[model samples]
Target: MGIVWRAARLVERRPQTATASSLVFVVPGWPGHLPGQHVDVRLTADDGYQTVRSYSLAAPGDGDRIELGVQVVPDGEVSPYLAHDLPPGSDVEVRGPLGSWFVRRPDQTEPVLLVAGGSGVVPLAAMIRARSRTGTHSPFYLLYSARSPDEVWYRDHLANPDPQVDVRIVYTQQAPPGSTRRPGRVTRGDLDKQAAQLQPDSPVYVCGPTGFVESVSNLLIDMGWNPAAIRTERFG
Candidate 1:
């Protein structure tokens, strides 16, 4: 609901992977946000040139602090700065808590199926965090895909055992030593395993690049998931 441009100062930065990082911004007077909303980050240069890019929130509401996960685009304008150069006290302008289609509220008690690819895991991670922060007991199934073991964001937290959530990590480019799954994109069998854990009316959220989202969404539909019950947000 917040559409005004607010001052956001970087409070912390944590490396998520070799090329991605999580940026914590303290936006004073930020109206709390839901699980999957995104914000527009605007940067103004000394010459009065400005550029804006949208980034998904990496966590749920926590007072005035908002977290964003950024993946560097080698030739892009904004991502590189957000991921690497912006110092801890530097300020930027943010306009958000935008998009409602992919969000999940804290009180929704149905089983949840989350499918994330590459850096798209940011917002879904917010949903996971929200479920924990609010102490809800809804069942969670997360099927995450990355290019390699090293590119997995929030690695330790996702790997940590949680009684209410089931997590399966699949690699597309390189599989680590002793890994049971081969290096490839998520196959039908992956969704098959998760599909069994959810009920007929349970909601599914999918986020990734356009192709990955399209592929997974179609597979879920073929495997009997209701298209209307599946929410998707795609990038690139």
Candidate 2:
């Protein structure tokens, strides 16, 4: 459905990490959404320069409200506005519950491997939430890399990495004082370790900044998995 009205409040805005905010809107006439979908937001200033942007849905839908994970880009047109100008109880126009191409369902039995870079873990997090909600016991592996411990999104929930779901974090810029996972970049060797630990038949989902997604995807193909078995989404 298209956006006929705007939300009354911005509702809730919470920062997940230093660079991103988790926003939930209590919009009336809200339509349901799949985990990995996104919505287009239209922003207008009083002076008449208008802009529109698309952002991924952070939380899965049970029907009422929609949640978005937004990263504040310095000097970015939309992000900065969201970070500074837009506030809880503020009004904005959004049209969505849109995008059919990227929705994920865990109805099948295949194990899922999720690889993410920086703030790009937004959508992949939703997929993980979906798997958890359905009580599906499929094995999941999450390889997320960030610049520092403070920069990694979803860091808190990953406190205990289960046998079925593996979580590995890499710090490219700097690791905190005495960290465990290796420092530097997310290399092919890291992907190899994840692949080795996972069952051979699992399907993989990779989302992140362009370079990390490309590098990881290439590494997977080079490691002998079929190209079609790996799915990807890039967030710029």
Candidate 3:
């Protein structure tokens, strides 16, 4: 059976990164969800042709509402429908906290490397939030990439730091006029340099588009990190 939830109300909807919207939903009596699990969003047309899309939940298990940072795909039917048609008070039907394959508790002493590309930063963001909220002492290193400054999701949240988090922003497409942006995607060199900054035996979490995930995963492999030491989640 599908897990069902009612949209209690829209708390906030704002542009996170370029072409991405971060939405907070308050479902009354909502069951909390894990960091990386996603919910299937069900939408039906007036003619009854139904469509379901799965999106990862970016909120932690706080016993509160759920949050989703949706990066609307260009020419995508379901995302566009939700972005444009769904209003604040409109109740959305969702089935989740699905997918057992996700990141969970790790050693508080093991340094964490969180890498996010575009909207793939959603899950990593959730982990960061959870760690801070629970007062875990894990050292977090975030290397987030976006097309440009305007597209970097959670820029404000990252810049305004809690004592428990450390974050960096990388841009591949357009850097500020006078600034130097490392050309292309996150490279082996980038991963190596960042990994060197941390203590040995650190755990890594990688999220982003499939290409980003694959490339970073391979780079981590080449850097002498065990496949088990790195965790990843991907989106189109």
Candidate 4:
């Protein structure tokens, strides 16, 4: 599809964690997108200096309105402003619903495994919501890795009890109270337990920082998941 820049206004904003936020924008002419799609946000300064960054759509499409989950990169050029300085009614140029290979279509019926690190859960969260939104019964297992309990995004949505989707969290820095697993990066043992619920052919999607994605993807491949079947997206 031929995508062009469009005007988007921040209609609402909410904190997801200490360093992250969810921004809701209402674009006048947003083309609906699939789960895992992202948009390019262009920020222009007072002197006309401009910069752009890509952010995955945090929510399933709803008319001209969309949501983005942003993690403040302490020294980043754009993220800091979007997560901290941007206010309701502010205008920013957006151009996307971009990306293709990592998306999940609504009609897909096979079981799915999604592994996310830190804010990487943003897009996977959209996939989970899209599943529920369209009434698709495909079973999903989401294993999320965050630095600590307070850093997990979409806390309520992931915690909501659901028989169809199994959600798990691994803390790399601080584990939640009474949690069994001590603070650590995800390991083969973790995958062993979750992989038991899935068949050999089930598709797996992994997203996170470049290093985290690489580490998780290698782990999945070692566990007999087909290399071509494991889709991945990485940032930073």
Which candidate number has the best lDDT? 1
Query: Lowest-lDDT window of 10 residues in candidate 3?
Result: 1-10
Off by over 4 Å in 2: 1-8, 160-163, 180-182, 199-201
Each prediction's number of clashing residue pairs: 0, 0, 1, 0
lDDT of 4 at 226: 82
Local distance difference test, per candidate? 0.92, 0.78, 0.76, 0.91
Report the C-alpha displacement of residue 228, candidate 1, in angstroms. 0.3
Q: How well is each residue in 1-236 modelled by candidate 3, as lDDT tens digits?
A: 44665444566777665467767777676777767777777766779797888887887865557888787888998776565556877666677678776665544556689899988888888888887777788678888887888877777788896766778777788876776655468887666667887744467888888999999988888887878878888876
Clashing pairs in 1: none
- Cα deviation at 47, candidate 4, in Å, is 1.3
Give candidate 4's whole-model lDDT: 0.91
List the lowest-lDDT window of 10 residues for candidate 4: 154-163
Q: Which digits, one per residue and each the tens of the lDDT, describe model 1 over residues 1-236?
A: 43899999999999998889999999999998999999999999999999999999999999999999999998988898899999999999999899989999866988899999999899999999888887888789999999998999998899894789889899999989999888998888988887898875589999999999999999988888888999999999
lDDT of 1: 0.92
Poorest stretch of ten by lDDT in candidate 2: 1-10
